[model samples]
Target chain A: MLERALSGSQRYWSWLIFLLVLMAIGFACYLYQFKVGLKVTGMSRDVSWGFYIAQFTYLVGVAASGVMVVLPYYFHNYKAFGRIAVLGEFLAIAAVTMCLLFIFVDLGYPKRIMNVVMHPTPNSILFWDMIVLNGYLILNILVGWNVLAAERKGVPYSKWVKTLAYISIPWAFSIHTVTAFLYAGLPGRHFWLTAIMAARFLASAFCSGPALLVLICLIVRKVSRFDPGKEQLRTLGVIITYAMIMNVFFFLLEVFTAFYSGIPGHKHSFIYLFSGLDGYGKLVPWMWTSVGFGILALILLIVPATRKKEDTLAVACAAVIISTWIDKGMGLVVGGFIPNPFEKVFEYWPTTPEILITIGVWATGFFILTILFKIAVSVKEEVAS
Target chain B: MGVSRRKFLKISGLSVLLGLGGKAAFELLAPGSIDAAMEPAPIGEGKRWAMVIDAKKCLEKQEKDGCKECIDICHRIHNVPNFGNPKEEIKWIWKETYEHTFPSRHNDYVSEDVHGKPFILLCNHCTNPPCVRVCPTKATWKRPDGVVMMDQHRCIGCRFCMAGCPYGSRSFNWGDSREAPKELNPDFPTNMEYPTRSKGVVEKCTFCAERLAKGQIPACVEACAKIKVNALHFGDLADEESEVRELLRHHYAIRRKPELGTEPNVFYLI
Candidate 1:
């Protein structure tokens, strides 16, 4: 099935080559970072985590979003999703791959990463995160491959594959929940200490993840013979709408709590992100941009006529993706570190090399995604014929 | 002719689980073996190390001549790099103003003497250390003596411990310490006996565990005492008659962020 990816149109080959070039550039920057240490990045003793961890956080949501389709198809018996369910699983594979890569690039000692498993501390959330993420990645690969393989042969997937798909539903929730615990469980980071963090993570993930899948499905329609189906795409758009509403509602709940309580610790990060805390608001513009996109996405997704139109739906999904990406990937992580432990503001911005390395990792993920999608689409085309 | 792919995957997965289970069983049966491998010889048995900083005395000395003997000596002995940029600077012990050191306690109407006064700051070596709790590798842990210790060799430099520390006590080696410019750190590793850390590791004050092992007090305490300020005191908190305990008994003292429930071992006499 993978060999189907080997033969593609000139456009497909060109896209892969383009991604490879970006990956090479990113790898070169990474090598430079590895040599000079994390100082080459925009992190400091104050903001120890920067872009890498932020991307890791965002990608975790994307990875978990695959359950949206998987659960509907397998448990709810939604027939429309059957054609694109494998696409969701494949997207998860790519997203999880990116998540792992982001974590690796962020490590101060990438070589000693195995130490997490070597001297595992059950007390640490990071240990559980490592277990859940790797487990989720494996589960998706197994289920995705087997299901697609069975489909190519025009047979029902085996019982084990069905069981794995069922298990993956809850496992998807676990990956994001554990990632939230990585932040929420830490003391003194008031920004992340909220009880609603896991809920917020799930809400945002459902919206952003499906929104991304919608865009990809549209792209797949253009570039491949597999029609992903209008009903399937419409169902996903509805999922994205409800999830984005929940995501916004959850954020407003946080705002109400922080302002109503009038606690400086609770309010400081939000103030810094939105209105500049004590004259340091590096993320202010980016945060507002996210807010703008969120409102636009809501407007586009809520109207039935616009939602039915493919062009409008694509615009809405793009807005949701950008909004969620900025909110989680840029604002959420960096905001927690501001007004540092001593109530001082030390800003963080990614350096050139850091940005390049990040781009490289994204390219790598897309490189894998292109091949996987190619194979899945080819199989679908074969089955249809 | 060969094992099927599914069967091979099952066999490998089961073996990995078995290997982990076997290790767990070994540790459960003889926990001392793993403990002995991880911990060095205890500096003192059944002891809880604590420090008392006489903030009033320290402030008086600072006003008199800007005394920074404690900071200088601790950094030198610990081989903390001087990057000259606050963003990348490393310090095991340093100073912060009263407001900055205790942000929760800062107020607009505080007395001139207490307000804006510099306070010596270092790791609190919390009884319930968040850093130790969040370390994925147990690279940082609370010793039996109540000192939070960091094993740089074991640290993966994920900086989770940095995020976990509420007081910003932990510092990561973003750049190689040895490569620090001569003007900034003229005598890098001023004490050759102490090992300077490599790039990409979290480090913090160890409560001078090495000095305590040699039957000497922390360098900061020694430096302060030598200067006749006698502002820094270190002793066993478990010992009722110890100087630290005696100071706490006589003087009103406060630990930073006591409400957070970290129960920091370091206390300041105002």
Candidate 2:
């Protein structure tokens, strides 16, 4: 059974070789980072958190997006998501692993992680965040493995697995919520201190996360013989469309509050992000690009002709994911810190070390995803045969 | 064995019940509640450290030679690095010009704007400090006395405190600050109280906690008193008979950004 599952087209071998080369290059950069301090990265006093935190923020959203599949299948009993349920779970596993790696690399001393545990602070959201992230990862593994094993043996899935599935619906929400709390609880940075931050984060996560999953599913169907069908794709596309609308609405709400209140603390970030401030226009171009791509993706997904076509839908998903990634990950963190606490403009651009380390982490996620998907797809095939 | 529907429901119920019970038991046994209530041992008898700055008197002095004697002494004693190069400067104590220091919009009633006058600013050591509330690692905390402080080793360098501070007094060490001068002060050498800071972590004025531990005034207050400027005053804010309290009552004193509800310990008299 294992041998039959392992057999695939020559493309898998070539893809593996490409990933290995990328991984080796990334490893070399990581070795340099270890030898030196964080000085290798482009982070300075004003912009302390850079690419690592941006990746962490984006991956947490992706990890939470697993709910797009889990909720409909487990709670609503929508059987259309059944084929891709395991895919969502595997994606989560990959995303969470990348999340932890981003955190580990960002820390000055990753060895002292036990200090957080040894002397716990219950009031701190970071402690709760760590707890929920790890717990959610474990839950996915347990549920995904049990279901796959049951399908392989032609037996009923464990009853406990259903309960785990229901728990993960809320657990997925918790991971992103805790990530938001890490920023929202902060006092000084007005850009992050908003009450709607968590909602906005979840909205964006749902939009991008499911869009990415849908695109992957389409590609899988084209390459292989497994088709999830047009109805399932349409349902997922509609979900993505609604989520993107909510994400945009949330962003506009933030802008309205900032300008309406006339608080320099709040309004300054919006101005700095969308427009230029004091000749510091690094974020302006990127932010507008995100906005343009986001609107374009939304239109494509909504239009009947584009949504119906598999190729067009795939492009729309890719566009939405890129747009959301830029808005939440790169532009957001950088824009928040530009006119720093001192009202001084400081900019951050990723250095070679930062870019290489980022690539390494992304490669690591892809590697995990490849192996997990192999197991899931193989088991599904056995069930069919 | 085929699992029955009844058995599945029963198992699910029991597992959830047990999980909640376990969580409750863990909370009761945890050290958090106990340690939080346990207060630190008192520092000095009838002496809670405080600062009283006469803003009107400060305006009378020149910008360069102004009441900055306190700032100079404080930074030097603490081995605070002065990169001199504006791009890489790390200051524990510094001055803020009037426009930067005060809310320019608020003083609508006063026509004559004071531009040249600088306020010698540092951490307010707020009674209800916002920075302490936001720290994820419990690195920055308040002492038994009125002073707020930081533990450098425990700091994760997130710099939330720098953002939390409304005064903009806190600074992050972008580069190693130890390259400034090797000749250490005999009075207060570099240690945990004044440990050498690395790049990325947030730091600010500690109100000379080490000096207060040894039953002496803060370096700034001592230096300002010596220079005969008499602009900067220090005493217990809590005590009615203390110099800080007397000045606050007799003279019109204000705090920076009183609207923010930080309850700043450092008072400014106009």
Name the top lDDT candidate: 1
**Over the stretch A143-218, how does candidate 1's per-residue lDDT look in tens digits?**
9999999999999999999999999999999999999999998888999999999999999999999999999999
Name the lDDT value of residue B185 in candidate 2: 34
DockQ of each: 0.72, 0.21
Instruction: Report the Cα lDDT for residue A270, model 2.
Output: 80
What is the lDDT for A233 in model 2? 85
Candidate 1 Cα outliers beyond 4 Å, as residue runs: B1-42
| TM-score per model over all chains | 0.94, 0.86
> Whole-model Cα lDDT per candidate?
0.94, 0.78
Clashes of each: 0, 2
Maximum-TM-score candidate: 1
Q: For candidate 2, lDDT tens digit of each residue in A1-385?
A: 3354366778876776677777788879877765555667777656767888889999999999999998998899899888788889889999999998888777654555665677677776777888999998999998887887887898878899999999999999999999998878665577888899899999999989888889878877766666767878888888898899899999989989999999887887788888977778777888999999998998898897997787888888998998999999977777767677556677778789888888888888888787777777777766787
